[model samples]
Target chain A: MATHRFDPNFTDNVINSMGPKTSPRLRQLMTGLIKHVHDFARENELTVDEWMAGVKLLNWAGQMSDDKRNEGQLVCDVIGLESLVDEITFTLADEAKDAPTATAILGPFFRADTPYRENGADIVVTKPKDGEMAFMHGRVMDFETKTPLVGATVEVWQASTNGLYEQQDENQVEFNLRGKFKTDADGRYYFYCLRPTPYPVPDDGPAGRMLQLMDRHPFRPAHIHIIATHDGYRPLTTQIFDRKDKYLDNDSVFAVKDSLVVDFVERKDDPQAGLELNYDVKLVADAK
Target chain B: MATHRFDPNFTDNVINSMGPKTSPRLRQLMTGLIKHVHDFARENELTVDEWMAGVKLLNWAGQMSDDKRNEGQLVCDVIGLESLVDEITFTLADEAKDAPTATAILGPFFRADTPYRENGADIVVTKPKDGEMAFMHGRVMDFETKTPLVGATVEVWQASTNGLYEQQDENQVEFNLRGKFKTDADGRYYFYCLRPTPYPVPDDGPAGRMLQLMDRHPFRPAHIHIIATHDGYRPLTTQIFDRKDKYLDNDSVFAVKDSLVVDFVERKDDPQAGLELNYDVKLVADAK
Candidate 1:
């Protein structure tokens, strides 16, 4: 009998080791993935037949993808890999520096170019009675100074009064319910657009099949998108969902941060305002 | 800026406040699994979409399962999870304790009922000309006593001549090339079976698709399966693959152990032996 030490890479003994040298980051990621994947297999006593089935599904997912839609990316997001990455990114930030406003999955619908507009300009985008007219005004200010940061760009978009994205609606005008506005000297900016309504994501693709399997709905609450940016301030790509939305708490993307949920107030018979809405503005500097 | 402690489980924030409440073994395993899974999720920046996709894949894997076929298990084997468990299981014994022959993947095609035969019986299983007959003989000795152990059952199976498993081949007879042999008083046993041929796994399924995606081929070398057991002996489930097989260094399941490879020698014109092929075997007992 011979004394022996356990070899960690026992599998490499028979299979000629030919893997490329991996960077620290990739090694860490692959190691972690392999361990968990291995554990999952052991816990389930996964069989060969079952494994092949997974391969087939992944292949199908790849085949389902096209230029217009990335089913693979959608699948990756649904599996919580995207959120996991976001969380890791947040963790890697310096403790002294607060993270930027929470980032969410850009659900494969954001367009590249949005028309810019002047401050206080009406970005009504379209004329539709399905959505209520709301005036949104906000200011970008230095967090410490409490002073508005003038000349900041605020790009905004929202689902129509019917709560469906313009891209999903062939009848809706292109870029309807979406526009860009710049802040005035006082760092104030206002826009006119119908309030967004809750709507379901496309349920006809492979992602839909996944949702059906989990018995989960694919609805997102009414929300107004905003991409605020200035020279010094960190670009804030965020959205504020209507607190009154039916799916406010159960947002499909898990993007509903507590601070990002806002109540839509109603004001009637305001002769001076000349509208049934009172808009308010607030600004804070980026946390250091 | 405020100083913050680098606390683990920040989001869940569920510290193990109740200390020492569980067995150390269970606690270690649970903690290890949690950390591994969480780290994997973190490293992958796994999005909600990806998470859902994984979950959906799992659910679909379950849906595609049947009593006779388990693709999940096969995946586990291919990824070497089962082999890892087996290594942990057998390596617990001290080095002075003889190690049993290495165990490999049982694969998804094995069955329980194989014909039991006397010592030196022929288990040609298929047509005589389908594959070359090999007269295999081996001794099961108690390493401590250096004595042969008789009355031990040796189970064996292999792929047919056409590189296809009985489970995968509708044309092959049930339990083809499968049998169990008991050792004679001399601790030697021999049986005739068709030589195995390298075969590809089911390529039409998800597992096949995964291989395609990764640009990997699915091929397992020709091998003879064996599980030898006797009273007070640790059971051994191992396989002896032909050394000349093309897939020897590239087994898909990572089941090929260095010590498990054996050569099949050609013996021509041996009138006394009346055999054309021969091979030797060595096995260590399982320490109690």
Candidate 2:
């Protein structure tokens, strides 16, 4: 057996141990992070067994993640960490009535290298028998000048009406419900695809268990994910949530921003289109 | 793109969302944990990419752990989370001069079902050519009564002189340097094994990279781990640290305590033994 002593300066000792070569940002980040984590554990009198349980849960999350899924980010999302961080980073401190549309959680399902499509092209590779046709048209404009930003690229993705992303459904073809469209001379982008439906996050992993413990539902409101970029404007990664979805107010990831919510309208002219959304994007200039 | 609004009650919202069915303790723990983690992120104004990188790092740590090694715990160890928690949980609020000896981290290497050995038995299976033999004798007693605790089990384990625990080295025999011995009627336990040498934590993983970034060394000082348990008393998991080790003050795990330090003396009687150590133990009865 051994004796014990309280290190009155345990936090300082750890923070100071950082090598002089460490960048100031890294040191500051680690110092704050460690202080918070240590304070939490100490204040709670966290036991070794309880701490080990957390380690095991994290391990389970890692084991459950792969190219098609990321349980790691899901853990953060379910805990409100991803949303909180999104708020902290994307929200301008200035109280500017308008900035570029606020960003949203990219989530774990975004796929890179999606195929580019011409305006009005369909991203639906294999539409469900009961799926409704939906069209979205939008213009990208500078927030301050209210002027068009020509030739912007709007990369878009969404789950199917059946509530599954391409990677999660083998019936859907490669890059299903995903496309990148370039704005026309009017700075207007146009495309059509199946309307997305609310779906549950993968509920077999650690986040699922966490939700179960918290007695919270695991559903995210139906939404379209977008990454809009122009030559001199700040790039945006965000989601357009369906205003009618029941889960919007209680989104499992807490990522619903009222501005990002849009109501679907009945298609008036195109017999092929069952619904339509007309949403415009506002962009902020890049920081110097 | 859509609109945005700041939930002034973001932190409180998250804390209040916990279900009524959740155990009070779990709710409290989660609330505190989420508060600290959220406050840290918000205060730092961590960018999305930086937050994602941290998530990826935690995932990497999880991926590096398995049945034989746990990088999750190691991450906590190097950052002093585990040590801080140990101090908070095990350190009594009262200033009692005499209590049971203190505890140390039961690092990832501990295995169940270790073979039991008779008193004076050896744990070293295949010693290194330059390895020195060492013997340890210990007595377990009641802290308040100063009376012997007979028939108690003292479970001990150590890395070989080569600084590799059996599980980490394929060349080492099964359960090498691991054994449990029962104390005699006098509350004394005895065993002989190879002297442990300073060893580095597995540094090929995320924790390793963290240490590298922090400009910190990864080596823990030489020490023997023990878990002493008896019926009707609190169990004790602790360490006997080699006093002469250079890293004693800067142990990589921050586990070194003044009372746990012991000097190894030259063996006078046994030509087969290179060093000898005698450490006693004290136990506090379990609380009612």
Candidate that would win on TM-score: 2
| Interface RMSD, prediction 2 | 1.3
List model 1 lDDT by residue over A179-261, tens digit each. 77778898878766666788776667656665554446777788777777787565656677787789875665555666677
Q: Report the number of the highest-DockQ candidate.
A: 2
Q: List iRMS for all predictions.
A: 8.7, 1.3
Query: Candidate 2's error at A9, in angstroms?
Result: 2.2
Query: Each model: TM-score of chain B?
Result: 0.83, 0.94
Best by lDDT: 2
Which regions of candidate 1 deviate over 4 angstroms?
A: A1-5, A11-32, A35-288, B1-26, B48-61, B94-100, B128-130, B268-288
Per-candidate count of clashing residue pairs (backbone under 3 Å): 48, 4
lDDT tens digits, residue span B169-198, model 1? 777777777778888888877766665678
CA deviation > 4 Å runs, candidate 2? A1-7, A92-98, B1-7, B92-97
Candidate 1 has a DockQ of 0.10
* Fnat value of model 1: 0.15
Docking class of 1: incorrect
